[model samples]
Target: MRGFGDLEAEIMDRLWSWGRAATAREIVDDLQLRRPLAYTTVTTVADILHTKGWLRREKVGRAWVYEPTCTREAYTAQLMHQALETTSDRAGALLHFVDRMSGDEASALRAALEQVKERDTP
Candidate 1:
């Protein structure tokens, strides 16, 4: 239910954006373009992410390749849900959230709600 740390977020962002499994070395290399990072540091954080169930990994040759267990969108939803849970008035919080949405985002939310409503109708 908790969010990722700085390096953890960096690693997850790379894997999600890449849309494929990647070894820690590949992540480290990509991160190096933005800032210096050690391979071992990335590997250790990746292992932590795996343990935390945010990532799935498999041994490929001598390295462990990692991929996200959920999409970035799913993660965003979970964080939003968690934020709502922290408020005493969920409805009020949601109203505030809706009020801040742009026109396109509001339209998408309405469309998604309609789909859910149609699916739930019995």
Candidate 2:
């Protein structure tokens, strides 16, 4: 998962929601919650994502359609790994992660641990 600025996250969300491909104009219209974005801004972000390997683009007539190359789960795992990499103290980071997690995240941690244990069983 790549680390995204808030706008990038919203852009990725729009692409992921489609699960196919969308033009920059489509993305700008979709993310109207923050503020309406210029098509050029959307195009720039899509270009960045493509260059960073986070997005794939296909030619569609005069425009390129962009889609997320990574799934939401994969993106999240990558982001988590990146965060962990930046922490100087692994233990402290883990504790902070646990402490700051919402209930759902805590539960997801429990589920992941159980799955890991299950995989370790003979």
Per-model TM against the reference: 0.96, 0.78
**Candidate 2, position 43, lDDT:** 86
Show where candidate 2 strays beyond 4 Å: 32-34, 120-122
- lDDT tens readout by residue for model 1, 1-122: 88889999999999989999998889999999999887888888999999999999999899998999999999999999999999899999999999999999999999999999999999
Residue lDDT tens for model 2, 8-122: 8888988787787898878888877668678888889889989989899999899898888989898888878888998799899999889999999899999999999999999
* Residue 11 Cα positional deviation in candidate 2, in Å, after optimal superposition: 1.2
Instruction: Name the TM-score of candidate 2.
Output: 0.78
- Candidate 2 residue 71 C-alpha distance from true site, Å: 2.0
Regions more than 4 Å wrong, model 1? none
lDDT of each: 0.94, 0.86
lDDT of 2: 0.86
